[model samples]
Target: MRKTRAVLVSAAVVLGATLTIGATPAHAETLAGVFREHSECERVGTRGTDQGWWDDYSCEWEGRYRYYFLYA
Candidate 1:
């Protein structure tokens, strides 16, 4: 009975770890979405002459300029 309990506990721990790891990507995607939504480009303008445009134009995370993490 003691061995069975230990095995169950170990299995639970492994499952919890797997779930935590799996959740990390989802959390990252959410965070990236929030970032993009709040980014200067979207809040300001794409054109260089627009107010706050310099910040957006210079940003690397702008959707139009970004190549990596496409889903994000």
Candidate 2:
């Protein structure tokens, strides 16, 4: 009975792990460097989206640069 319980628990754990991993959402890729101007950042982002390099992008001005986050 103990062995059966252990097997059931192990199977449950494996199944749970598989489901969790499979259910994970896709993560986006980001720009490697920061942009000095918002216009520059938006320009690159727009080009990327228009040319099919990325699905979409959003620019955020933070600190000294405009950070471009790209999503596939």
Best candidate according to lDDT: 2
Q: Relative to the unseen true structure, what is the Cα RMSD of model 2?
A: 3.2
Checking candidate 1 for backbone clashes, the offending pairs are none
TM-score, cand. 2: 0.64
Clashes of each: 0, 0
lDDT of the candidates, in the order given: 0.47, 0.71
- What does candidate 2's lDDT look like per residue over 6-67, in tens digits? 99999999999999988845664566345766777788778888898878677765754335
Number of the top-ranking candidate, with TM-score as the measure = 2
Q: Write the per-residue lDDT of candidate 1 for residues 1-72, one digit (tens) a residue.
A: 999999999999999999887775533321122234435534333444355323322323556845322222
TM-scores, all candidates, are 0.38, 0.64
Instruction: Supply the TM-score for candidate 1.
Output: 0.38
